[model samples]
Target chain A: METLFDQELVVINMGLEDFAKTLKERGTRVMHVRWQPPAQGDADLLSLLDKLK
Target chain B: MSKIDQANKEAVDKMMKSRPVWVDIGRAKDVIPGMKDNLFLHAGPPITWDRMSGPLKGAIIGGLIYEGKAKDEREAEELAASGEIEFAPCHHHNAVGPMAGVTTPSQMVFIIEDKEWGGNTFSNMNEGYGKVLRYGAYDDEVLNRLMWLDEVYASVLKEAVKLSGGMDMKSIIAQALHMGDDAHNRNRATTSLFIRTIAPFVVETEWGKKTDYDAPRLDLTNVSEYFGKNKATAAAEVLAFMHSNDLTSLNAIMAACKSMALAAHGVENSTVVTTMARNGTDFGIRVSSTGDKWFTAPANVPDGLYFSGFKSSDANRDIGDSVITETVGVGGFAMAAAPAIVNFIGGSPADAFDATNEMYEITVTENNNFNIPAMDFKGTPTGIDVRKVVEKNIVPRINTGIAHKDPGVGQVGAGIVKPPMEMFIDALKELAK
Candidate 1:
């Protein structure tokens, strides 16, 4: 059986703070994705989606 | 398969087969049996009256005032202390609520039905923004808003749903997960999708017709009014409210997740966790192997950013049943898919992805329904095992809103919380038995 320690880690970095920092300091690979609400949750933009649909 | 593997498979299969849909709105007393006049249901595990936390007490008082049992907070508190008012966990009644999470007999709850598993679950309505009753604020403004939601909002939604023949909640949730919402603290995408789906239905509902059959045929000022001129205002208000509150879909998502977890409950010899909740006083978890019994520990205060003028010291211990989102693989477990959640939950985008990656270590499998695009469309980790969690030394990571420690003070901030390891240790021991 493959154990947790034997597997490689792939990290998703929401931002470079706190928990992600600790993981990076320990030399784990991290991938960062800049996250924000879709279309900034704009009412006009959302209504536009309604139109498209 | 080994005995443990077979048990785990049985548990995961039920969870995957669950098809929860938001079917109706119901009063607690009507849909949930044993909900009497004095009974008030809260989040997390069962707790005694004296041991209740401040926000919880505040919610009970608010529930009393909302139900007309008492005129004010003082009278409400007295009624609660009189021992006539009963307190119970929402989970005990197939219901869940956020914050003080007090679900009273009169409140309207979203009723989610699981077609596959043949059960229905409920969650109390969400009060948008701060100073609402859910966080324990029970002033006139809060009461007025609750009354409006119960009287006006619920009726409009119920009619629109009936006219439009209801919707599939799982479809919206699956799309929301794809569109970058964890569906707990951040629901921008899901909120937009829900309002967009229902706006047309709401428009179909004619105002004044429900009240008067002979309601005057409007001599419209503008014939070009595409939406009924009278109903446009109501539709506008609903859309605007949903737009302003990013967490509007939270209650529905929770109801859906609860349905899935309910299906996973009561499987013999399975170590899968069915519920992870906090009642501000204690953190509790229920394992599939152990049935309804709760393994609890001292609740931990969350670590995250505090709103302006509030310090971490002012925050209450973790509270509410919002963890249902995480229990079925959305919320914090899918943080990598919703990097934007860090803005509300207080972390970096990197932290969000790291959290999701770490969760895979403890969970039994990834959920096919909730997929993360950033991770090559990998499903969010699902099926928490008491045994695996103990062996790996990892507790479930939770996304939560922080309430004030003092009653009626309302929310202070939001952040990440972890269940204590001790509860899992107790659950593992139970499984061994």
Candidate 2:
């Protein structure tokens, strides 16, 4: 049953703020996504982390 | 089998063999033999006038006019008070009615027999909502439609069902359960299967061919359309199936849920809870491992979306036959699979997931067939265990149709709600005894 939770994942568009708030309230962990043109993979990841802090 | 197992089996067998008497009402005396006045017909369980909400009262008034017991709303009220008519639960009579579930003596009823066990059940013809009789709006139009159904539709269906060698409701339900229907709120799959199975016979009926009659026809207009077209037909078939197999496991689900909740039912040390049920008056519940007694409390208003022009105030407290679903681990427990349900019950996609996840804490089994893909195909938590409930201090969640506490209100909306904890406490006390 615990393993069932490990496999469960959810994806949300960056624009859904209310959805994010709801998720946080429900105690679900979240990861932020940075907006960038396709191909800026690592840069995008770093910027996303910076935005999170 | 062990002695306890034998007793359980016998109880289950008695339930399986119970049957309803069939009556076609041409007059009120035909059906209301023992019923009391001031009572109204509601589906599933018996409820009284004081416990009823606004819409339910309206339905009772509407029934009076439809039965010619009164000429106007004021007259209807007086007649109701005069104790001239009778009121009884559709369930007590082995019958089920749509929405407000008002069935007068003149209304045509389909008396279905479960050929396997000899158990029988009844249901009145469906009156499509929107100012219909079941919702307690009685006028010439409602009366006229009722007349048409009794005269034409019931006759056609009676012959059609007989012609089809009787419907195999058990098979239909088994298939529907797999097709995303709990067979309570989401009857689309069950409705479609019923039409498909019965269409061949309905097409052969006299009513099927006449263009002048303009009666609602049963056609394969897709699954959703089936619910709209011949709801009564579908309801009858489902009821028949439910009554057929003694081991249909519906009550078993309820028992299982109760037993699981027993673990947490009444630990002075525990906060986790277990059971919930509605007696049509007060909603009641029990905690895990607490026992068979119910702790009852007044039901609360449901939080959800309503049909157009309908408001929360018009809705009744939560009611229905579907609480068995919560006992077995679906309905609100599996909200993630039915995201479209959010539109009817006021919730977001995330709320749906959370509801499903929260249920996992108190339940025992996970249903394999009723899986949610968004949750990585995890099965909906199935049996609510009392131990888990007590350990976790969580009550089971239920998504239900809110009937107007008043008879005429019909259905106000669909929403998520919880059962009162008192029932569980009561049940716990009994078990402790």
Candidate 3:
């Protein structure tokens, strides 16, 4: 636990990009995953996706 | 694997294996299939004079004046609206055009043949830039330039291409990708390579080689006399004209891309997109499985840096058939290969990399030939699958030249734009059925 606290924290931030940008600005190692809600969170397209499965 | 998956694989394989070679050049009326004297081919889906944008309308008017169908702008406009002239999309005849994408029958076209698939595609000659016919400027100057290109320049280029056998466009594009060209908005490297490859052959043209089978052999010892001094002057003029314009090869490259895309079309049950083009007013796409059916939507305006006297508001909606580059996985999808393009299209080098990186999320696979060194030599994200586009809700990115909204004003800027997502969703809906 103490070693974990002493080491630099690495982060993978998803969804909003600004969160990752803020983390990197503070000297943290972070990777931003460019993300979006599948089908852009549309209900009808989501149901249609169910048909594909 | 699912049927769609297997079918899409076949389509992409065909696209990747295409070998487009510049085989010949001729007038559109002579070479293009189904092209006729009264028929004019514009870009994107089928549209009428009413729905046509200012740039496209202006180009049609210019085509009339050039064809001698009308004497002046007023007569041209009346003739265009009189319903005497027939209009169709260039894609209907296996052809592509840039900017306003107006191709009249009298214009010269580059004939590109797919050596692997045996299909031929065509595109009209590029008229350099600014106040050109493609961008809707059709004054006496534009018409005179077109006449020269259609007659003098076409004859010279035709002889050179015939002498060189055929220019391998696929290989040139592959090499240009490495030399900082996306092969669409940034074709500086492509144009340079084109000039280098054709310059030697241009000089050796059979300019004055005369033959009379029954007559006595004339003394033809002098090389300059054999290939007339007129030929030398024309050859020098041709090379200079080609060098003066950085986009000399754009139309040729567009034809090559169309050839590649056409090879991928007509595969059963595939989700691969085979065409993406806009005719100023509307954007349209065709899928392999759907055949010739076009799913269309209203085009969105571009956002980017304007010229010295222009702003974003002065720009028209996204235009041209150049987005065919993006469909075949270069253009905007391969921006990482062309960081220098940011100066013309607006953005930083990092933004360019990010743009390419984001495209991978929605594409089916990376290309085999178009490798980007900036991405650790990774291939470009290729094959836009309709299902992936809808599921991810991401639209394909396109780099384009912006024309002025009003006719005759010419290009106001260059920028990045995206087609409306509705078309992809509509395509997906049809595929699902």
Candidate 4:
């Protein structure tokens, strides 16, 4: 088993798309989460997401 | 609100309230204050001709020929390199340019005045895309089109705009936002909307004076039917050019954007960004609080898919004043408004949506006027904050056309570019000072 220090650090790019490209260029492992506004930013749906959160 | 918050709010509100009027056409030296006869303005930050990029040099040569200062390209090159002509940044003169972004003294520029803010901005007219002066192509065809725009289209629009009063640019931009126009890279919708807004007035205005040239000239007394007489042919030519060039309204829209952004440029204690522009060699940004000082870094070439027969190696570094749209919260920051733009930048609809959504992270507020439908009527992001940009480590993304690396060659691709983070860091450090 590889130790934590020996393992590659992973980057989770939550929103901005430029980050993923920049991180990749610098040789970082990045996972771009498909981050969208809650329920397509619907006011009523946002309250639902808020309750769920 | 706190003092800083209030200042930022006032700045953004002033920008949002700006109402640009299609005012007039005039020579750059007469219209733009402080424009000297020997000086030429280019886009992004300032640089002398020796260090200027290929496209910029090409545009300078083209402008010299257009102004009748030089007989041909070879002579123009010598004059430009002889330390005879001075170069200044367009931003310094309340003007903006696309691509090479060259604005010369004799060039007739579209003046967009923000009536509500009591200020004005200007830009040179657009020549339909491929092999045009803006992208550094200085062929006979490009020079001919420039002459046509200067003598014909500029004269026609000057009269028509006066006849129609001022076409309300704010409402058109508001409507275009919903109709799939990011108003930057993908402006087809905005161009069409602008045409619709002005076409009726265009036909009503008289065309052509009896000039010796066979081309469309404005005849003060020769009033006629919509398409019945020679004067009608003049109006027809302007309309024909409009219909042919999808990028026709880009320069007009850029002027409007510049007017809006200029409204927010001088608010004290506000870290809101007022400009992010590139001249192919350097990318520079201005912060509202920092006055007009520029924080610059070498421009980065965009990474994207190219047009057929062109590779990344053939592409010039990113250039243009079109990013004025991004500064005022339209371009890539509103990409979700024009998801179809993904095709132009080699991305998916999801990528487009993500780009706009992500912009919210670094922005100070959302534009209440420009609402995005797909996002359930949420306002698009607005007011880039230098502090937030550095803290979050994000920069504004620009959707731009890629020109060829060598002079006289035209656009090679369309792509997205981000100004260097260093400029934001530098701005933030200065603001802290």
CAPRI band for model 3: medium
Error of 2 at A33 (Å): 25
Candidate 4: which stretches are off by over 4 Å? Answer: A1-53, B208-232
Q: Candidate 2, residues A2-36: lDDT per residue as tens digits?
A: 78667755545364366667786777666544233
Instruction: Give the range of the ten consecutive residues with the poorest summed lDDT in model 4 chain B.
Output: B216-225
Instruction: Judge candidate 2 at residue B147 and give its lDDT.
Output: 68
What TM-score, to 2 decimals, does candidate 2 have? 0.62
Best by TM-score: 3
Q: Please report how far candidate 4 places residue B410 from its true position, in Å.
A: 1.1
Residues B194-265 of candidate 4 have per-residue lDDT tens digits of 888788878777763322355543322323344444534556667767877788888888989889999998
TM-score of candidate 4 against the unseen true structure: 0.86
DockQ of each: 0.02, 0.02, 0.53, 0.04
Error of 1 at B127 (Å): 0.8
Question: Would you estimate the TM-scores of all the predictions?
Answer: 0.85, 0.62, 0.92, 0.86
Residue B268 CA error for candidate 2 (Å)? 26
Query: Candidate 1's residue-wise lDDT over B1-433, tens digit each?
Result: 6677688788888898899887778778888767887899999999987888888888888889999999988899888988888898999988889877899998888888888888888887778877888787898878877875665566667777777676678888889988988878778898888888877877666641242222222222342164555543444445455666777778888888898898888888787899998999999999887878999999999988789999999999999999988888888898998898888777689989889998997787889788998899999899997766765566788898899998888999999888998898777666765
Of 1 and 3, the candidate ahead on DockQ is 3
lDDT of each: 0.80, 0.53, 0.87, 0.83
Q: How well does candidate 4 score on lDDT at residue B250? A: 87
The prediction achieving the highest lDDT against the true structure is 3
Model 3 CA deviation exceeding 4 Å by range? A1-11, A22-29, B208-232
